[model samples]
Target: MQWRGRRQSSNIEDRRGSGGGFSGGRRGGGLRIPVKAGGGGIVTMLIVGAIAWFVFGINPLTLFGGDMGGQGSYQTSETGRAGGGVDSTPGETDNFVATVLADTETVWSTRFQEAGETYPEPTLVLFNDRVESACGIAGSATGPFYCPGDRKLYIDLTFFDQLESQLGAPGDFAQAYVVAHEVGHHIQNITGVLGKLNSARQSLPQDQANALSVRVELQADCYAGIWAHDTRAAGYVEPGDIDEALNAAFQIGDDTLQRRGQGTVVPDSFTHGTSAQRQEWFKRGYQSGNFGECDTLQGQL
Candidate 1:
């Protein structure tokens, strides 16, 4: 991973202590509460959290109560933001993420330039327990996600700890792979893949929709591999880094998660492909480093 002493991004919004609550406000100089669709308010979040936690055995605290640091309300103020009362703090982990983000920007910007297109870098939001996004309010339990609505990446660094202890995928490169996967989603959004998929999904049945989502997710994995390829070319990768990332891809696969969460595997319900498929597509992207080779939508899986 060797990410130390690298450049950190300034586009980070550090809200590690904003707590969990929803209110209406503008994004001022500090933490700004984002307004978007799909927010049903606190009561709705509670109901949704209970169902997800009790029934699915997933942690619901990330949905309702974010890290128990502050009050749970959906509003942001200059003083409300944590992390030294600024948008971003220069912590070690923060530096690591910012560096990874910068690397992605460099790789994609050059690639996009080669294609005669512009690459709009995405903002990465760092939160502790909960954060409001254009997609919806999310808790740390939601994991890292890319919201096309806002063109931002949301992540709670504690997820890295969970990745190590709970998911058993440890290492800096693995963490970078997570960031790259979300950035891959951003690439998809920019490339019109997401738009076309959204339009197509509107008329699709549930099973078919899930299948399309699997392709989308797998393609994101492949895109992550592309980032890895460029990263290695830039001399940032070390020995065992690729293996760490591959193991991470395996650990977070829908099949692995389902088998661990429940007792069975339902391929029809799979949305992110199996471990083998994930690893395969990632390897494909890393080996070829060609965007066209990463198309899982038109090609057979």
Candidate 2:
């Protein structure tokens, strides 16, 4: 991906060394619930927690406390770094993240404007170890997530290392796909799809809820592809970029991850779709580059 030298997003919150404490900023006050569990390790805990929170209508925060409170400091993307224990100079990875985020902002804003609507840009919080959001406290293990409660995206850059080393999805484009996927969730949140799914999941059984969650995740994958589509049109995508993203979607598919982790594939428990479904949806959006092609909820998958 040719992301360097491009605009960087100013809506980034750098809280890398803040010890996952609370920040008294725009959206504040969340309990610091450390994620500690045995057997499944950190990644497993994250996947299970994600399924519970996203598919089963269970709020991870509610399991520990009502609201979180603490004192911490952070730096915006434009400010480089803050006085906290964070590094004084932003690194290459940080620059890449901000650049990708800015691209997403540009693409989504243009799309929204074409539809006669204004896009509300989301803040991307970069943290280390753990972080607090309107949703709850999340450890680095929880991976990158978009909190609908606060309309912000949270990521620990270390997760990208895991994505390459453990998940077998390497390349800068794969990392961009991950960021775009989370941003896709932010799109869902602003469009009311996330709210509707949360409400609908409340009355559904686990299996049915998992099915809907799969659709939602696949839609996000397609949305990520939409971002990639725009990037390609702008001549930023290099050779093999789309393939890198596709590999990432395949590596993180529910079936692939389940088989790798548990030695079995349980379709009923899949919150995200299977490898083929994920790749297909992403391809659909990438090829069409139209928001109408991303109706994973009603259209054929």
Candidate 3:
């Protein structure tokens, strides 16, 4: 968490305070889709929508065409102030985000070089309210996501506050994990996992598709752990940093979120794994720091 005065990523695209500005609503906590009805058909549709979003890392707003369930709206918190968003000035929360991004770049670039491959750095788009990507339009309520269509990561920083306040996961490292996880999705995209997934999902049943999505998300969590492993090796991670990330992985588990939201657990609707599975995959990556170990699709999930 000692990120002050470090390298900040120049790939940031700031669109805050501009036109198409934030529509202003708090999305429901956790990664699960917000289904309005608990009926079997509604649950199945929600699962399909959520899995489709995960397949390409599409923003949920774009998945539902704006109101996701149309219930439990909250205000989006700003890092600096309400009217003014993050400034380019150093030592700010936005700069901290850039620093963490730079850290991932350093780690991944080195690893890719070791493997005789060049790392294609991804641009991170910082927007408020809504933003348009090659995939489609995304609202802040969709949370942070990486769109494979454009090879970019999009975030509304206010989701960080929601991660802390609503999801009960807070800390600098937790925020770093969020960014790293999205970048993990980008890694999958570059490595062709997403491409194969896209083609395969089309021929699979809804249940099988959801299961595959879980593997995809769990692999991303493992990749995040791999990044954390590199961070530790670089002497950047401090005590309690791993705990913050682990808690984050736990808080956003599909089962945990579903139980909290509707008092029931629909295993078929789980795109992301359970809390134990998430922590386990992350720990596996952190312990080995091996790309082979993070292969959730090929190996046991």
lDDT of 1 by residue, 1-301 (tens): 7566776666676665644311111122224344232335664454233222221111112222234232121100123221111123335566677788989999999999998988999988777656776555665555677666778887767667656655667777777888888888889888878777776666778789778877888898899999999998998877777888899788777777767666688888776778899899999899899999998998422
In model 3, how large is the Cα lDDT of residue 221? 90
Q: In lDDT terms, how accurate is model 1?
A: 0.67
Worst 10 residues of 2 by lDDT: 70-79
- lDDT tens readout by residue for model 3, 239-260: 7778888988888887777776
Q: Per-prediction count of colliding residue pairs? A: 10, 2, 2
Of models 2 and 3, which has the larger lDDT?
2
lDDT of each: 0.67, 0.71, 0.69
Regions of model 3 farther than 4 Å from truth: 18-91, 299-301
Candidate number with greatest lDDT: 2
lDDT of prediction 3 = 0.69
| Ten-residue stretch with the least lDDT total in model 3 | 71-80
- Specify the highest-TM-score model's number: 2
Candidates, ranked, TM-score: 2, 3, 1
Measured with C-alpha atoms, the lDDT of residue 161 in candidate 2 is 61
